[model samples]
Target: MSLGSSKELAENKIILLYMIDKVNMPVSNHHITKLVLENKFMNYFILQQFLNELCDSGFLELSENGGKSFYSITPNGKKTLEYFVNLIPFGIKSIIDNTIPEIRSDIKKESLISADYTPKSENEYIVSCKLKEDNFTLIDLCITVGTKSDARTICENWKNNPQQIYSEIIASLTRKRDKTNRDKDKDED
Candidate 1:
């Protein structure tokens, strides 16, 4: 959703700043949407609008190659994030305190799975397992892996048979161990 006006856009920047501070990394629009939804603070439209504003204001960078857009915090964005980190504690303390009860209730209803677990649904599982360090999700992971193929393979296996996916992931990592050892040996030589 597009942000309504300059004023609303400013509010979104504040929220995005808070999000960066909370997550400590570049966040994509998808991650921001999840946080907003999870916290019951705003809708997806507003979140997207806010992100666009931040991008326009030189506070964030958006990459376009992947299915998910990646947003990295700029130096200016970092400054804004820092300012909000300090400001929010006191400015919104009362509101935050009041919201805790509801937040807790929502948290109880939302299912959180670990990175290691296979997801029941393809979309839900990918959304859940994607790395959240800064604002990136599984879609970002797919982009970084250089193709949707790897992500699709993993997702397909995960959905069709979780056990098989787990075994494959384990085997893939085990193969990487030997490669790592070889790289280390070359370095030593």
Candidate 2:
């Protein structure tokens, strides 16, 4: 690459690290793509290349969950950005700082709820639902269904109503049952 192109590439890489660091959490690949495309920082293809390169260079960590990829800046990435953040233009950095809060909130909210399905056999599918906070998983549930449609429905319900479903599940599991007549009589005797 020419010097100009190399400089641009470095800036773009720094921008990705800066964004992930500012978000300060594991953000889904989809969200990162959306943020970059929405900001017109670079084209989709280029952004993907940068993400791959960052991961390869140990500047970012990648995790897979529910078939989605999430990215977080590595400590090395933060150190690098701290050293070369000046490569990014002032206005661009300002935009990033301003844009991060809303994106962070959205990422945090979305990361809490997850649902996915995988085929178990010709006629069976397993649906997985999860609720997570920070680094902890609050709930991880899986159910098998006879059909794909059923699995999809279950996944949707879990995603849409995880809180209510969690509450109901906990209540049912912990509910106190009245003593049986025989047990009560035996105790009295």
Candidate 3:
């Protein structure tokens, strides 16, 4: 499909809207681009242009968090999609449907675990790691390290092993003191 044709352009826009609406959540641009490109639906530049145009025309809303752009369908976008979804080819729609579950899983995982680091001084840095669900933060851990490399390593480790780390931390914090050791200490005293 060539971009010069208005019909093809409109269909592409509808395709974008349909994907976002069906996904039923705020989807990051990176996720959308990956889906579209992996399916050979469009090239990177064209996909980006369509996204910007959609936002400009009130068809989609853009929100940014943690340096990632998330797109969600606006009411107008949903209405327009409802009217024009037929323009999108059945094969394309099928592909999108097949991929939605994986996309949802990825988005959920991405949103749940987050880590970042900022420099506090020439030799000091603070790393923040979080586990969140919806708007609730289950854990927000901050650690200060003496070097940028250490901060970066901590952030990377947190992202890669958040569940294990969270479990370990919880276990350590909640573990009961050894009763035998306490009794022995009392006896010694």
Backbone clash tally (model 2): 0
lDDT on C-alpha atoms for all candidate structures: 0.54, 0.89, 0.92
Q: Name the candidate, 1 or 2, with the larger lDDT value.
A: 2
lDDT over C-alpha atoms for residue 187 of model 2: 89
Which of the two, 1 or 3, has more TM-score? 3
lDDT of 1 at 113: 15
How would you encode candidate 2's per-residue C-alpha lDDT over 159-181 as one tens digit per residue? 78989999999898898866796
Judging by TM-score against the true structure, name the best candidate. Answer: 3
Model 2 stretches with alpha carbons more than 4 Å out: 1-4, 63-68, 133-138, 171-189
lDDT of each residue in 1-189, candidate 3, tens digit only: 456689989998999999999889999998899999999998899999999999999999999987888999999999999888899999999999999999998999888999999998999998999998778998999888999999888888988998898999999899898999889999999
Q: Give the lDDT ranking, best first.
A: 3, 2, 1
lDDT for 181 (candidate 1): 88
Off by over 4 Å in 3: 178-189
